[model samples]
Target: MNFLGFFNITTVALALMFIGSIGMLVVKKPIDKVILYSIVDAGFLLAVVTFKYLDVAFAIAILGPVSTIIFLMSILKIDRIRHNNREGGPNV
Candidate 1:
């Protein structure tokens, strides 16, 4: 690809990362934060691939969703615990 094309892709990747980071700071909900985290991960993966690091990009592709799943599960667990406490439900 031409340098201009590479530059455009890199610019888009960085923009996505920047937007995700800003959104993470601004959003109040835990789910929103997790979503933004995934966006940032996607941007990073794109940037890696743009730089021609196929191996690292592959690793990120495999691990990014796993880490996002972990984040989501943690958020769900926390929400459940909070709801139980509020409702006076039995302890898990």
Candidate 2:
């Protein structure tokens, strides 16, 4: 591609990453965090795709869902721990 095309794609990828960072900082919920992470991952993948690195893009895309799932699981675990702490002791 031409220089202009390359510049445009890079600009878009940067914008996506910036927006994802903002979302990650501003949002407090687990679901929102997951979404923001997905956006960031997408931005990275877009950058790779723009540079014609299809193998890297495919690898990143495949890993995205697993990362998201792990994030969700951690969030749930934290919430459960907090809840248990608040409840004082185990039930009879």
Candidate 3:
């Protein structure tokens, strides 16, 4: 790719990450926050890949899915705990 093309791609990725960050800040839902954070991570991946940072890209690619999985798991755990507390049950 040409220099201009690379620059454009990187710029777009940065812009996406910035927008996702703003969305994350304004959102109150845990799911929505996770989605926005994932988007930001995707942007970072795009930027690194476009810049030919293959090692960084691979590392971040692995982290992206792992992080999302962990976030979802935590959210589910919290919801279950809250529900159990509300019901006054100790998971029979």
Across 1-92, the per-residue lDDT of candidate 1 in tens digits comes to: 57776558889899999999999999999988998998999899999999999999999999888999999999999999999999999757
**Which regions in candidate 1 have their CA more than 4 angstroms from the true location?**
1-7, 89-91
Least lDDT summed over 10 consecutive residues: which range in candidate 3? Answer: 1-10
TM-score of 3: 0.77
**Native-to-model Cα distance after best TM-score fit, residue 11 in candidate 2, in Å:** 1.4
Off by over 4 Å in 2: 1-7, 90-92
Q: Tell me the alpha-carbon RMSD of every candidate.
A: 3.3, 4.1, 3.7
Residues 2-30, model 2: lDDT tens digits: 77765687888988899999999999887
* Candidate 2: C-alpha lDDT: 0.86
Residues 1-92, candidate 3, lDDT per residue (tens digit)? 56775568878899989999999999989899998998899898999999999999999998889889999999888888889999998852
Error of 1 at 30 (Å): 2.0
lDDT of 2 at 25: 96
Worst 10 residues of 1 by lDDT: 1-10
Candidate 2: give the clashing pairs. none
